[model samples]
Target: MGYEGEEIEGYYCLLIAILGNFDASEARFLYEYGPDHPVCQKILKKRPPPVNLAKMSKEEINQCMYRLFEEGYSKRSIADLFSCYPSTVNRRLTIGKKQDAEKKMEERRNQNNAQTDRCPEELCRGKP
Candidate 1:
C-alpha cells in the first residue's frame, strides 16, 4: 500500500501473471521482495510449464535475499520490510555487515590521512 501508484499496478500484474490469483498479502509480499531478484529474473525468463508462484522454493527466496544484501540493504531493514526476522536477513549476507563496516572505516582512515598529508604549499598558496 505504501508503494507508489504505478509500482502497485506493476506488482499486481507481475504476480498475477506469474503466480495466478494471489491474495493481497501474497501480492504485497512479492511486490516488496520479489522483483529485481536475480533468481526471479532467471525463473521468470525460463519458467517451467504451468508456472506456479505459490510453489516458490526456499532456494528462490534465498537467492532473493542474496540479491537484496548485495544491494546494501541492512539485515534488520530487510527483515522489517519483508516481514521476516533479522536472523533470516543475517543468514543471507555471507560477507556480513562487519566486513562492510570495517572496509568503510579503513577507507575513511585513508582519506583522513591523505587529507593530512597535503603539502603546506598547497594549503597556504593563494589562487593566482
Candidate 2:
C-alpha cells in the first residue's frame, strides 16, 4: 500500500507511502520496506484497530441504511460496498424498514386529509 509522497498523475499516493505489503481482502502483506522507513515498518508490526460502526452516530447509521435500501442492495452487498461488517447491514436494514413504514403511514394520512378537505367544499354545494 502507498500512503503519501509524489503524485501519480496529480493524485497523491498515500497508500503507497503509508502502507506497505498489506491487502485486507487477500489478508496478506506482500511488500518489505527499507529499514529507513520506520512508520510503514511499525504499521506492519502492529495492526491498527478496526472501525466500530456500533459507535457511529444515528445520522451516520441512517445514511448507511438509506443507501442500502434505496439502492436495492443486500446486507452482504452493502457491507462490501461500504467496507463494513455484514452484521451492520442487517441491523441497518431492520431500522430502515421501520422508518420507511412510518414515513409511508404519515404520507397516507396527509393524502387522506387533503382529499377530505377537497371533498368538503363540493359536498357543501347543493347545485352539484
Candidate 3:
C-alpha cells in the first residue's frame, strides 16, 4: 500500500524526536503520537527488542555514538540508546575523539618522518 500520509508523518516524527525532551525509544513515540501512530505501529510490529548496549564492546559503543552524532542524534538520545547518563556519552565521545585526533597526528608524523624516503644524494639533488 502507498504510504503517502505515513511518509508525511515521518517529518512530524522527526520534529517530535528532535524537539521533544525525550529518548529515542518506543515509549517516547508511543507516548507522544499514541500507539496507533504509524511510527509507533512500525515499532510495535517488531517483536524483537533492540540490542542492549551492555553486550557491546567499548569501541563499538564509541563508533555507534559517533555515527549517531553525525546523523544528528542528540547526545541525550545516544545515551538513552545505551541506557547511560548524557555526561557519560559526552565524556566517552570526548576521549574517543581525542584518541582519533592523536592517531591522525601520529600518522602525519610518521609520514613526515618518511621524508619521501630520500637519501642524502636525493636531498642534495632536490628531486623531491
Per-model TM-score on C-alpha atoms: 0.33, 0.44, 0.48
Residue 74 displacement (Å), model 3: 1.1
Better of 1 and 3 by TM-score: 3
Instruction: Kindly list the per-residue Cα lDDT of model 2 for residues 28-89, writing each as its tens digit.
Output: 22223333466555544443334357687875666556755575555654565557798877
Return whichever of 1 and 2 wins on lDDT.
1
- Arrange candidates by lDDT, descending: 3, 1, 2
Please give the RMSD to the true structure for each candidate, in Å: 13.5, 12.2, 10.1
Among residues 3 or more apart in sequence or in different chains, the pairs in candidate 3 whose N, CA or C atoms overlap within 3 Å are none
Task: Report every candidate's CA lDDT.
Answer: 0.59, 0.56, 0.70
Off by over 4 Å in 1: 1-24, 27-88, 91-95, 126-128
- Candidate achieving the largest lDDT: 3
User: Measured by TM-score, how close is model 3 to the native structure?
Assistant: 0.48
The digit string of per-residue lDDT tens for model 3 on 35-119 reads 6888877655542225567688887677667666666667876776678899998988887777677878999999888886769
